[model samples]
Target: MRRQAATFVWRAALAAALVCGIGLLPWLTRTDPALTVLKARSADRDPTPEVLADIRAQLGLGDGPLRLLGQWLGGLWRGDAGRSWISGDEVTPAVLQALGASLLLMAVALVVAVVTAGLVCARTLRLGAHRRLDGRRTAGSGSAVLAALPEFLTASVLATVVGVQLGWLPALGWYGPQWTVLPALALGLPAGAVIGRLLDDLLPGAFAEPWALAAAARGLPGRSIARQAVRRCLPGLLPNLGLFVVGLTGGSVAVEQIFDIPGLGRTTLQAALAQDLPVLQAGTLLLVLLAAVAAGLAALATRRIAGPALRDGALSSLHRPQPPTRGIPTFVHGGLLTLVIALGLPRDPLALDTTRRLQPPSWTQPFGTDALGRDMLARVAHGALDTLLLALAIGIVALVAGALLGLVARVSGPLVDTVNAVPPVLAALLVTSVAGSGAATPALAVGVVAWAPLAAHTSALLRQERAALHVTATRGLGAGRWYLLRRELLPAVLPPVTRHALLRLPGIALALASLAFLGLGAQPPSPEWGLLLAENQPYAERAPWAVLAPAAVLALLGALAVSAAGGIRRARPRTSATLAERPSLTRELVETG
Candidate 1:
């Protein structure tokens, strides 16, 4: 009961902090709330002092943040979310309507994701069981590539080829069930690929367990064993699934914009940009609450799925890090070959020739020309250098920050969950709201949330490592915390965590590009990849290459990173008494006592 009370207290604290942060946003950004509200209400009028005073009084901007936050909280308690600054309508109805649409879209997308993950996992297991090593590797390569594709890029291609050219599905608007398919696919496929990959990595270890051996010896069918193996993997996956669900509620900003779906993500982003305090506060509150609730529910589901094993610590091993596979996948070689050709090309990205605008690809202009007649090949090549260097720098910084916080400081899990709940798009909006967009705005935004996953992973690994027999023995020998951390803990944790961070690089790059595409990053006339996609989107039909060039290069970069990270093989420790050599009794003793 006390533990549950503490949990409730922290969750409530997180919610209050989010609301307070929203209320304090104007002041933090150095903008006058009265002026912002006045402009939203009457943009044509000058901001005279008397009019500003009236608007301030009307919006209660004169009150301190604490008082305003308290009033907002009190109003929320009474089921009133206040009135919007832009529309002047009650906040509850509009937020609820948008929330409902988001929920429906999430539900459909979840269904699609579940099916795709199930199929991929099943195929992997089936192939592994048959000892088809080549087939398993090939199948995994495709999904890894698919997982690398960003939602915005995926949506753009699907909308153009399937909706516009083929005329099979509606590309834009939120009208009926038919409109949901494209957006759902855009979100679901990559999510499914990630889930599938995690599960595939877990299954091999589960099948190798003694329980599976006993089940097979007892004449249980292969299907039954596979089912049991899958069940064991679920406890480890549920939390991540919950995280994805929470992220989808706000991270689908790009998809919502592309499809013109008036979901919560789109609505909240619009409100943030327009400085609609009432709606922004409500939406932010709902998202934060959804994250907390989803986390609580995911924990409950994990306990239920884990069953009696929860007490015995049998299923705990399922959550530990697995040794990553080494050797570059065949797909990476293909990406490298393309890179070689791109490097050898000769063209000036800034050379503008109006007569050759939108020229098709030929022996001379390999990737064709853009609207301004600049060489697409040259632009893509140049963009790659800037995009890649920035992404690598950000990835390294994020990895270090996450490592220190997770492994050294050991930050609170609730704090990590709460912060991670804010998606990159929303974070970007928040930073943009304060800093005003610049080259570093998207980087700052991405940096804010990028460290969460690494922290979570390292924390989990730390917990597992702390229970190892060697750790217990070293502690018994009077080893201090720093000694253990330096000699044992860091060594064990850093390698797998590094691999995990490597897998995240492509995602970080994609996120940076997503922000750029949304006009929150690089400005006009920049050869940034996402900016290129944004510029060429309108001419997608007339000159598809303009869009496809940058998109394809981005896709290739993602695929290469995924393949390289997936190929990494952790080296074995040069110790006579390895962890694997330690008795099971020693581990059990350390865990239980």
Candidate 2:
């Protein structure tokens, strides 16, 4: 165990370092002098011959990319970010400010995710016999949809419906807690869905173990069984927890830009747009670093949890247990969706003062005015409806498409595995970037990417369930193919499938939000979180904090997702009892002999 722990730690550390290195590339990257000169000339900001010579002398611009990268790496080791390209400002302070905001946002998001997910999982497990379905039934579907989305979708929807049309809150300002709602919800949905699905899928397996069966026979009941099983299954699961934190925060970049949240993602996007190399590099580095830490912790936890397959948390409670509700799924999911719409709406859905154009956020205007003099608040309010509608469409697109493709691939075996293993998000983004455009297209594009994983996971799960003892028993009883599939197969599969479907909401929302932020989803004069950030990018330096509020909201939403994922993971182990049953199997065989 000690040896395994050490090895896992080392490997995890290396993997985390690689993630950091990828993040550091932007900072350590050197601008090609030739390209810089050409770019500068095209912009009519060409440096004279003297300036070129001076730049070469000062920064060795003529050096190879490797050397420049190496030198930058050395400087970074000493904790220094070089000078700024545009304003000649020290990159340290600016980067620190952005990093601080980002860290704060990520931390806050984490809290939201843990609390929500944990409570949900604990409650679900505690509910015992009254359960309708394990959230895992839809896990594949939900994960596909959420993973396929970008950040901009949530931002746009919430900004329009909640911030503008309904006028319940300020769409643009970051003044206090009131502004944090929309973005947090946006980020949380998909993440939570995925987590919930994973837990649901895994938990049942634990419950079916001989010991769990014995506990159940003793009338321990379903809810107690669920909690006990989850407690025991942690050892085999937590290691799979990767840098979702990174994904969430990275998604936050666009999310922040849209809501004008004052997080690192917002600042970094501004840096990228302005070509502020130092700020961009630093901001990216911070994100990477945060992700790396999350990864390491996941790895460490995985290693520790593997021992005894979680015997500590496996103590079965001997108390009387209550029977659960039949078929009434927790409407907390509905509440989440409703809240998303609410955040998108404005209190004054009809109060539009369209007299001013491009007015800044203030007490009077609240969310302020847009470039076309439309009330930002109003635009944001309506945007909520659009955002939610689009996200729903996107979720449907990804879920159905991915399910189809994933199922096909699963039946195809190796071919499906290979294709699914590819970097799906990048591929989809590339396809969209190359061959697609507009709102629905991008959403579908992301959904397409998310499809393979959903298919693969669903296929694996269905295959396992189909091969379980119950299915074989049905077959022995001469059940027809259709009946076997409909009654036994479908029922077994539903929990995972449903959980997957529900969890996809938040991640897809984020993906949509990102597309909008990148100018892919929503276009100008439209009140959306992403477009809002893009509009504010030019003036980011003037009022950096303006963007912080919305960005934080997005981050918080993402955090909620992470929390849900954690909760789902805690719900149950997918292959529960396998390890725990090994010893029992040996004993049974010995006894038979």
Candidate 3:
């Protein structure tokens, strides 16, 4: 117990160090904040050296990064977060207010997701294995499709159908429960779909377990057996709830913006745009802390609820050897689509024709023309190539790096845990500071952030596979490490890795879009979807098509990726008896730590 306490203390210290390091990212990356503020406030006149020095001294920029970090930490310790540059208000109060609103939004969304998932699971449990499989496939496909839609698009559709068309709720505002209904549903629906699929997969193997069988042998009703199966699946399901929380929090940026909610997400977005360092840092820190705390609590709950037998059983099931199955159709389609777009699209996306600006969709230009009169079809097609290239780069880099690191992590567990604790947004911001604004920069930033999750997943899977009976037997029989890994572990790891990569593509695309929207990715006239949204936002009232075109394409791409991943997961043949019962160690670790 003492040793464990010491280890926990060390881990906490390391985590604190990581957070402090992240807080200095803005300072390290940019020109001094004083200079940026001076430039923003006084753009017309260049400040003399004396003037610049005065501003720097005023803002405490005279101190080095370490000192600045120390001061910030000191302030945090004293329950103060300083002031917001944009609003000149006390940062803590504003942050607390925004956090409260966001928490409310997240809580409502989570409840919706859980209720929906429960209903879906309850209905699906009544079916036979084949029928259940079919139901899962159908549900998974639908979920993937819905999950592909970005928050803005989902909010828009919900607002239009439920609010505008039906008048069941108001289209905007955040006053009453009726107002919360649209945003909550927008956030909850996709998450519910994901949870439902997870429950679907786990229920079959759970029903087949010894206890479930014994209960059935005692002539327990089907409903009772189903309830028992669900209870058994809870430990695995609990970890994903943490992820859903993080996703909803991150996704709230776009939803809050669309709905005009004064939440932390919107405040963070505003800070990022205005380069308000204090608010941005504080907001980011708040999010990272929330995710960490939530994950830790979920992990503790799971560990407490799951007995040694269940934990051991679940862990053992994860390592069971199985024949690998390939799902090649999605890859082929993706590659072909990318190739066609890259080759068939116009050479230049920036060519502007002023006379034809803001034209709506027609036979002549299927996607319409933007305010610059750039052919929307050409721009979107070219943008698709850019988006696809970014996703591909992120996917390849993250997968390869993650797999290699996963191997290392198996031996150096503590190091991996420390690294994984660093928030992805913080990492991205750090990368962005050094790399600057460009397609490559955001791609690299996203790839760097993405690698942690993939690495964790890969490491956990590899560790389990290495401990399998076949691997132990082969090693005892004088099989070399290379031979064992090549013949055994790689096959076991590849299928899930492939599926994970597919699922990650949509996320990468969304990240790219978000960064680009913030002007940190694929700079002006790039025709990237996010850039398009940012550029045309002001003109949205006049030419709504400018925003809709890129949004629709982005939505379509996301849907495609999600659908492909779901189909592959569904179609892959199950070779192990405990196939669906395996718990994801990476997921638990990511959420918990």
On TM-score, the leading prediction is 1
Residue-level lDDT of model 3, residues 548-588, one tens digit each, is 87776665565466546545432232322231374552243
Q: Each candidate: what lDDT?
A: 0.75, 0.51, 0.64
CA lDDT for candidate 1: 0.75
Best by lDDT: 1
Supply candidate 3's per-residue lDDT for 404: 76
lDDT string, candidate 2, 404-499, tens digits: 554443233232322322222332333443455555555664565445445544554444455455455445545666666555545454444444
Off by more than 4 A, model 2 = 1-59, 114-150, 160-179, 214-225, 233-241, 272-277, 310-513, 520-593
Clashes by residue pair, model 3: none
RMSD of each: 4.1, 11.8, 7.0
The full ranking of all candidates by lDDT, starting with the best, is 1, 3, 2
* Runs of candidate 3 exceeding 4 Å displacement: 2-14, 39-51, 84-88, 115-140, 156-179, 195-204, 207-219, 269-281, 310-364, 401-428, 455-494, 533-552, 566-593
Angstrom error at residue 560, model 2: 23
TM-score of each: 0.88, 0.51, 0.77
